[model samples]
Target: MKQVKIAGQVVPAIGIGTWHMGDRPAQRETEIAAIQAGISAGARVIDTAEMYGSGRAETLVGAALQPFSRQQLFLISKVLPENASRQRMEASLDASLQRLQTDYLDLYLYHWRGDVPLAETVAELQRLQTTGKIRAWGVSNFDVADLRELWQLPGGDQAAANEDLYHLGSRGLDYAVLPWQAEHDLPLIAYSPIAQGDAWGQQLTTNDTVKQIALTHQATVYQVLLAWVIRQPQVLAIPQTSSVAHMEQNLAAGDLILSPKELAALDQQYPRPTHKERLDII
Candidate 1:
């Protein structure tokens, strides 16, 4: 497994996302199995959110990780945007800790850009750090401007990461966010690195070079897509998978390397759209 360090903490380049694992007994079992399989296969980072089925996901993660030592995992959870106020932030994080069955989270993120003042939220995160409840802190869904605001806050130097959607189809970060992250020594955690399955089938079928590359490596389209994202020096990818086979396949992405010519061909074939448009196809 490839690893990236942020704020002096190390995590796997590809981690398991547990958003869809809540609300059913059978699904919960699958979630636990997938997590166990991921860890056994060398995954260290596990991402969850308080809003995922109203804390059900956190509970599942807590129960699943109980057997493992806290130090062995880089657990991360996000506080909902509505609860961004200092008081609400305190309560939300405490509840998340309780649900996760852990005393401290390796990283805690602000789930969205809510009405609360940025300074207030950053200060509260700093306070959580002082109390040892959170080891590192950062934000999610925050654009470049929002990141600048957070960085200007007191104690914001401890902010470790910025979570966002970045893929072959969505290159929003490449234009601005990526440069900022690299300049500041902040690592960008890429979610939906496979474009939520949009990079398969027709997209790959129409491109002969991508097909030939996959054939040469004996890899699937998903594996090739994930490898492309992680190949970037300052990027880390977290692709969600419930099946053991898929989990293994995703983890193997770090091992596959695309030649510069192949990479350029892919970039040319699937040129990133200039404007920021949220396409449902992904």
Candidate 2:
């Protein structure tokens, strides 16, 4: 497994995302299996969010990871945009801690960007850090402008990482976010690193290059796509999987390497659309 250091802490470059595990018993069992499989495969980070099943996902993750030493895992949870106020942030973090069955999270992130003042959110996160409630703090789904605003806050320098949707099909970060993060040494936590399974069909179809490369390496299309994302400097991908077999496959992506020619060909196949176009669909 690959590792990236953020705020002086090392985290797995490939993590498990526990979003699909809702309140159902079967779903919870699958999530537990997936987490154990991922950890066995060398994943050190596990990401969950408050909006994921309205907190049920976190509870499932807590149950799954209770056997492991807390310090061995880089646990990350997010607060939704609507709960961005200082008071709400505090309450939300406490609730998430209780659900996660952990004393403190390795990282806490703002789930979205909205009307709340960035200063208030950052300040509260800083306060939590001082109290040792959260080891580090960052933002998710925030653009370059939002990051710039965050940097102006009192303790923004302590912000460890930024989470975003980054894959071969989604290159919004390439235009600005990637460069800004690189300049600031901010590690990027990539969600949908396989393009939510879209890359395996639309992006790879009729594209003989990717097919040839995958065939040459004896790897699946999903593995090829995930390898492409993890190849980027400072990128950590968290692809969700509920099945143990799929979890193993996702973890194997970290070991698959793509040739420069193959990488260039794949990049040319998926040109990113404008942010405006993306927002329209969202």
Give the winner by lDDT. 2
What RMSD value applies to candidate 2? 2.3
Model 1: residue 91 alpha-carbon error in angstroms: 1.2
- lDDT at 155 for candidate 1? 79
Estimate TM-scores for all models: 0.92, 0.92
Model 1 C-alpha lDDT per residue in residues 1-282, reported as the tens digit of each score? 567897587777888887667768778777788787888888888889998889998999898898777898999999987897888888899999999999999889987788888888888988888899999898887777777877887877678898888877676677677777788888887887877676444354335777787898999888888888888775778888778888888888878888888888888887755654442212
Query: TM-score of predicted model 2?
Result: 0.92
Model 1: per-residue Cα lDDT at residue 206: 39
Q: What is the C-alpha lDDT of each candidate?
A: 0.81, 0.82
Clash count (model 1, backbone only): 0
How many pairs of residues collide in each model?
0, 0
